[model samples]
Target: MNINIFRRKRKIIVPVLTEEKAKETLVRCQSCGNLIEYEDLRKNLKVCPYCGYHFRMTVSERINLIADSGTFSEIDTEIKAVDMLGFKDLLTYKERIKQTKKETGLDCAVITGKAKIGGFNAAVGVFAFEFIGGSLGSATGEKLTKLIEYAKKHKLPLIIVFSSGGERIHEGIYSLMQVAKIIQAVDSFKESGRLFMPVLTNPSYCGAAAIAMTGSIVIAEKGSLIGVSGPRITREVANKNIPGKLKQAESLLQNGFLDTVVDRHLLKTTIAQFLKHYNRRTI
Candidate 1:
C-alpha cells in the first residue's frame, strides 16, 4: 500500500531558568535589610549580601570548604549501628536508625576521613546533625577511636568538626560509653604528640561538646551553643531563669572553655592557618 503523507515539523519551546530571572524575585538578607539574589547568596557561601553575616552551614559543606580540593579520603564508611537492646520510645529504635540512615545518607553521625588543610595532612571527622540529632553512639565512638589510631599511625594532626545533641538516648548505656571511649582516643592521640583541633559548630552540646573540648586547640563558631545541657534542661534542673545566651560560644570563650571564637566567613582560612602553624611547630 502506497500512501502520500504531508509531515509537519513541530517547534518545541523549552523554558530555561537563569540567575537573572531568579533574581527578579528579591530575598532580603536576614542580618541586613538588603535585597539580594538567591543565587548570589548561595555563591557567597550563604553570607549576607550586605552585612557579610554567615549563615549556618551543614557538616558536609564545612568539610568541602575546609579540606583541600580532592584530598578527602573517607574512613570507617561501613560501620553501622545494630539494635542490640530492641529499645523503643515514640518509634522503634531499629526503625529510627533506618530512617536516619535514609535521611542523612550516613550510617552514623560522624564521618571520619583523611584530608589536607593548607597542604598539611590531617585526620578529619565531621558530625552530621541530621543523623539522629548527631547523637554520640557506639558507632560514633568507634569511628573516633579509629580516627585517632589513623592519625597516630600517620603522624597526622586530627581535626574534628563537632555538632551534636549529646548521647543517643535510645542506645542507653552503649551511648554513654562513647564519652569514655572518645576521651581515651583523644588521650592516645595526645600521647603520640600529635596535634588535635576540634572546631565546634552550632548546638555542640552534651557528649559532643565534652569530646570536642578535649582538643588541644578548640575553636567554636560564633553564636554557637556549647554546653552539656540544653536551655530547657538547664531551666528545669536549675529551677531558675537562665540567661538567654548562657551557653553560647561567646560565653564559653569568656569562661576559657574555647581557645577561639572564629567567624564562619573566615573559618576555612583560619583552620588552614592553624594547620599550617601546627605543622611548622611540630616539625
Candidate 2:
C-alpha cells in the first residue's frame, strides 16, 4: 500500500456567486474564486474554505448558530422604525422601513433575545444588515437600551454582535443621537457589575461602532471593519488616502483596539468560554 494514496486531496479553487457553471450543483467562492458545493459551503458555516472569507448571516441564523437549541426567544419583537424628519431621498423613510420589514421579517436592524450559549444563560443582541443597512434609528436605540436593562436585571452576561453601515442618515440628527444613548446604556451595565461583550462583524462602522468600543471584552470577526467612518469618507474628511486594511479588525487588534479577532467558526466557543469565566461569580 502507498502512503500517498491514503492522503486526502485538496479542493481546487473556482468564481463568485454571479457566474454560471455547467452543473447547477456547484457554486463559486466570493473571496478566493474557488468552486465549492452548496452543502459543503453551508457546513463550513459559510466561511470560504479557500480564503477564510466570513459570509454575512441573518439574525435567525446567527441565533441558531450560537444559542443552544430551543433556548432562544426574542424580546421586543414589535419595535418598528419611524419616519422622523419625514426623510425622503430616492425613497421615503416610511416606505423604506415598510419594504425592509417585509423583505427581512425584521422590524428593525437588531434581534434582542435571551439564550444559553454553552449552557451559560446570556442576553444576546444581533444586528441584521438586511434592514436599512443595519443603521441605528430610534427603534434600534430603544432596543439596545432595553437589552442592557434586561441583562442587568437578570444578572446575565450580554453579547451584542453588531455590523452596521453607520447611523441612519434617513433619520437625520435623530439617528446620530443614538450613539450617546447606547454608550450610556453600556455604562449602566458596567456599573451593575454585568459582563458586556460587543462582537463586531463585517463593515461595523459609524455610530454603532462608537458604542461597541466600550465593551468589557471587545472582540470581532477576523476580517471585520472596525472604525468610526469608512475609508472613503475618512479620506474625504482627512484629505488623505487611508490604507485599504486600516479599518479591518485584524489591523485594530494589532493597534491595541480589539481584545481578540476570532474566526466565525470559533466565535461561539470563544464567547461561551468568556461567559463561563465571568458568569461563575454572579451565578
Candidate 3:
C-alpha cells in the first residue's frame, strides 16, 4: 500500500444535525478523489466508496460503531481539563479548553464508560482526535485510570481506543505524569488476569503509543499510524525524515508490532469475536 496517499489533504466532513444539512454537504476523498455526499459517507462508516480509505471518526461515532445500542453508560462526566499552569501561547490554556469544549462538545480528549460490546459488558474508553489532537492531559489520565480501576473491580475486559497525537503540552509536567499514573493503573488491572485490548487508530504517538503497546493484544485500524514521536520531533531529534512506511499499520503488522490490522467496517465484528473467544477460555 502507498502510505503517501494518506498524507494528502482531504476535506473535513463536519457532522451536521439535520438531514437537510447532511444532504447539502459533500466531501472529497483524498486518496481516490471521489466526491461523496456526507449522508452517504456516514452511512458507509465514513470509508470512501471508491478507494476504501478510512476517515477519522469522532468519539460518538466510534462508540456507536463498537458499543451495542443504548448500552453505554458514561462515567466521570464532571472531570474536565483546566488551566493548571496558566499556560499561554496564542491562546491561554483556559481559552483553549473553552474553545475546544465548545467545538468538540467534549470535556477531555477521551470518554470512559461501561458498555456492552457484542452483548458482553466491558469497560471502554475512546479518544477523539479533535479534542486537542486527543492529547493525554491530567484529566484524561485520571478518567482512564479510574476506568481501568473500575474494570479491575468488576473483573471486566478493558478496551481503549487510542487516536492521540501526544501528551497535552498545555499541562506541561502534569500531562507527562499521567503516563505514569495510567501505567500503574493498567498494571493493577492486568494483575487480576483480565484482558486489556488497545485499539490504535490514526496518529497514535508518544504516551498513547506506550500505553497501547502494553495491552495484552494490540489492534490497529487499517491505514492507522503508530509511532513514538511525530515527524517534526523526529526530524529535529534524529536529523532525518520519518520513513513513510515505518508507522503504517500494515507495516507494523508485518513487523509484528500489531496483532491485527482491521478494517473500520469489520472492527466491531472482529472485536466481538475476540471477546467471545476470551469468554470461552475464561469460562
Candidate 4:
C-alpha cells in the first residue's frame, strides 16, 4: 500500500495593537520632532540625536553609562529615610517617602557603589533626581560617607554624580548636617592624597553645590544650573529680577568655579581621560 505524504502548513501570526502599546511603541524628540525608538533612546544615553537635546537620566542609568561593563558593585542599597520629627505638612512625611519610593524605586536620593572607569577602579555615587529632588537627608549623608570610606580603604578615586536641590526641607536641620558631614568626608579623602571627582549634573543647587565645589576636580554638565539658589527663588527672595542664565554651567566655568563644562555626549570620555591621567600620576 502506498502512503500519501502530507505536509503541515505553517501558521502566520500577527501582533494585535492596543492603545497603550501604540502609545508606548515610539516617541518623538520634544526638541526636534524626530521619531526615536524607545530602545534607541535608552542606548543613546537618553540623548536625542536629531536635536542634541539631553534627556533626564535616572541615577542608575547614569551609573550604568559611566561604569565599565559589568563592574558596578553597589553598596548601602537598603539605606532609607527616617521621619525623626514626624513631619506632617501638606502631606505626611511617611506617605511622601512611600510615594517617592514608588515613583523612583530608590530608598534614598543617593546610591553608592564601586565601579571601574577606563579600567581604573573607583568609588562611585550618584544622586537620584527622581527621589525627592535628590535631597540630602541623613541617609544620603551616611551613604556618601560610606562611599568615601570605601574609596579610602581601596585606595581608589571617588566620583560623585551630584544633582540635588540641596537639603531636604521636610527633614529640617537634620538634612543640613549632611552638608558638613559630606564636606568633612571629602576633605579627609583629599588629605589622604586620593582624588575626588564631582560630576555636577543640571540643577545642582543649595547644599549639593557647596559640597560639589570641594571636589579635587569638579566638572559640570553643559547648561547645568550650578548655584546655591535658582534664579526664580533668588528673584523672589530678593524682590528683584536676576539675570537669566546666571547659574548656567558655562557661567560657572567662566567664573572658575567649575573645572570644566562638558557636553553630555563627551562626558564619559572626559571622565575617562581624567581618570587615566590621575591613575598615571598616582602610579
Candidate 5:
C-alpha cells in the first residue's frame, strides 16, 4: 500500500523560569494545586493559606507544632523494628527497616515520648507515615501498649498523632494482631480513669482508624480521611459505593463521629485548651 503522510513537527516550549521562581519562590499545595511561598506556608504550619488544605507534616514537625519547646523527652527510643517470618519481597524486612530508619532517622514508624503540652504532662506518640506508610507492627503495638500503661501509671493524659495506612504485613499475622493488643491496653488505660486522645491526619485507615474511633477525645485535621477502610477496599469488600462525604473530617464532625475538626495552625492551642481543662479537673 502506498500512502503519503504529512506530519507537522511538534515544538517543545521550555518555560522561562527565573532563578527566584524556580523552587524557592513558590511551593505547590498538594491538595489545591496552589503555588504558595515557603514562608507563608510555614507561618500557617504547612497548611494551604488560600484553600485551607491541610498538608501532611513530618513527625518532627508534628511534635514541634503541638508540644511546647524544650519539653519533649522521648521514651523507648531503643525499641526498633525486628525481622520476623524472614519476610522478603524485593528486599528482606530487615533491609527495608534499615533503609527506612536511615532515611527517616527514627527506629520505628511510631515515636513515643512524655511531653508538656500547655505545661500539662502527656504521653505522646507520633506516627511517621513516610516510614512504611506508618504501618503498625508488633513493635508499634508494643510501644503503644506501653505508652497507654505509662499514661495509666503516671496518671498522664495519652495522645497519639496518627498518620497510618494499615498494619505492617511484613510481620504477617503478628501485625494483624496489633489492634487487639492496643484495644486491651486502651481499655485498661480507660479503666484507670486516664484520658486518651487520638489526633488523626490524612488517610487514617485500618488500625489507625480504630484508634481514632476509640479515643474519648478524638480530633482530626480538616479534610482528613477517617474510616476503617479507604474507598478502594470498602468498594471491593462491601460491594457498594464509597460515600465520599462520609470520609471527610467535616462530614464526620457533622455526623458526630469526630469531636472536632481543627486547622493545623490552631491544632496546638485547641489541644492545649483540652489538656488545660483536664488538668484543672484532675486538680
Candidate 6:
C-alpha cells in the first residue's frame, strides 16, 4: 500500500536554563499560587507579594536582613557536635551530623555571634533549621549559653531567633539537658538588666518555644507557628481535632503569649525601634 502524507513543519521553542538561571527564574508562591520572578521575591525579602506570605529565610539571609552591613562578627564558629552515644537507627548519629554539615555548612543547629542592629551592639543567635531541623542539642545549648554570657559581659542586648523542631532525639537525654542550661543562662543574663529579645519564626515548637518565651520581649514573625507542639502532635496527644489557628503567632499574640507579631517587611525596623527605645530608657 502506498500512501501520500503531507506534514507541515512547525517551530519548536524550548527554553534551556543553566543551573544559575534556573535557580534565579520563576518561583511559585506557596500561599497565593502565584508564579513570581526570583528577583522580585528577593527585592521583597522573599515575601509573597500577592498574599503577603513570609517565606522561611536562610541563616545568612536573616543575618543580612537584620544586622547592619559589615557589622556581624560571628563567635563560637568552631563548636561542632560529636556523636557521644554512637547510636544508629537508619543512619549513625555521626553520619547524620556529617551529612547535615555537608548540606548546611554549619557546625551545629545554631549560629552565635555579635551583630550591630540599627547601630546598637547585641549578641545574636540564629537557628538554621536545615541542620537536623534545628533540634536543641548539647552543642546548640552551649553556643546559646555562651551568647547569653557574652551579652551580659558586654552589657549588650541579646537577640535570638528561635526556629527548631524540638530536642534532638538522636542525642538522647543530653539534648533534653539543654533546656535547663538555656533557662539558667537566660536567667543570669536577665540580672544584667539588658534586653533579651527572641524572634520566633515558623515552627518554633517544644524546647525552642520554651526558651523563646523566657525572653524579656518575645516577637514572632507574622504567620509563625508558635507553640509547644505542632498541630499534628497536639491532635494525636489530645485525641481531638485541635483548632488550626491556636498555634499561630496571631492567635498567640491575641492570647497574651506574644509581645508582637511583625510582618517580614518591617521586622528589622521594628526590632531596631524596640532596641533604641529600651536603650534610651536604661540610659
- How many clashes does each candidate structure show, in the order listed? 0, 4, 0, 0, 0, 0
Instruction: Name the best candidate (by lDDT).
Output: 3
State each model's CA lDDT, in order.
Answer: 0.80, 0.82, 0.88, 0.82, 0.82, 0.84
Tens-digit per-residue lDDT, 77-189, candidate 5: 77788998999866788999999887777778888989998888899999988788788988988888888888888999999999887888789899989899998899889
Candidate 5: worst-modelled 10 consecutive residues by lDDT: 1-10
- Give a tens-digit lDDT track for model 4, residues 157-200: 99999888788888999999989998998888899999999999
Between candidates 3 and 5, which one is better according to TM-score? 3
lDDT by residue for model 2 (9-123), tens: 5243322222123234666665777877766766787787889988776677778888999999899988878896987755688888888777766789888989999999999
TM-score of 2: 0.87
Poorly placed runs, candidate 2 (over 4 Å)? 1-28, 235-240
Tell how far residue 49 is off in model 3, in angstroms: 1.1
Give stretches of model 4 more than 4 Å off: 1-40
Better of 2 and 6 by TM-score: 6
Query: What are the RMSD figures for all models against the true structure?
Result: 13.7, 10.7, 4.9, 15.0, 8.6, 11.1
lDDT for 213 (candidate 6) = 91
Weakest ten-residue segment in model 3 by summed lDDT: 12-21
**Candidate 5: global Cα-lDDT?**
0.82
Pairs that collide in candidate 5 are none
lDDT by residue (tens digit), candidate 3, 1-283: 2333234564444332234445678887766888898888889998988888887888899999999999999999998988879888767889889998887788899999999999988999999888988999999999999999999999899999999989998899999999999999999889889999999988799999999988998899998878988765676567789886788899989998899999999999888988999899889
Per-residue CA lDDT of model 1 for 132-208, tens digit only, reads 77888899889988998999998999999987879988789999998998899899889988889999987788888
TM-score leader = 3
* lDDT minimum window of 10 residues, candidate 2: 14-23
The C-alpha stretches of model 1 lying farther than 4 A from their native spots are 1-41, 48-54, 236-239
Clashing pairs in 6: none
Q: Could you tell me which residue pairs clash in candidate 2?
A: 13-34, 14-33, 14-34, 14-35
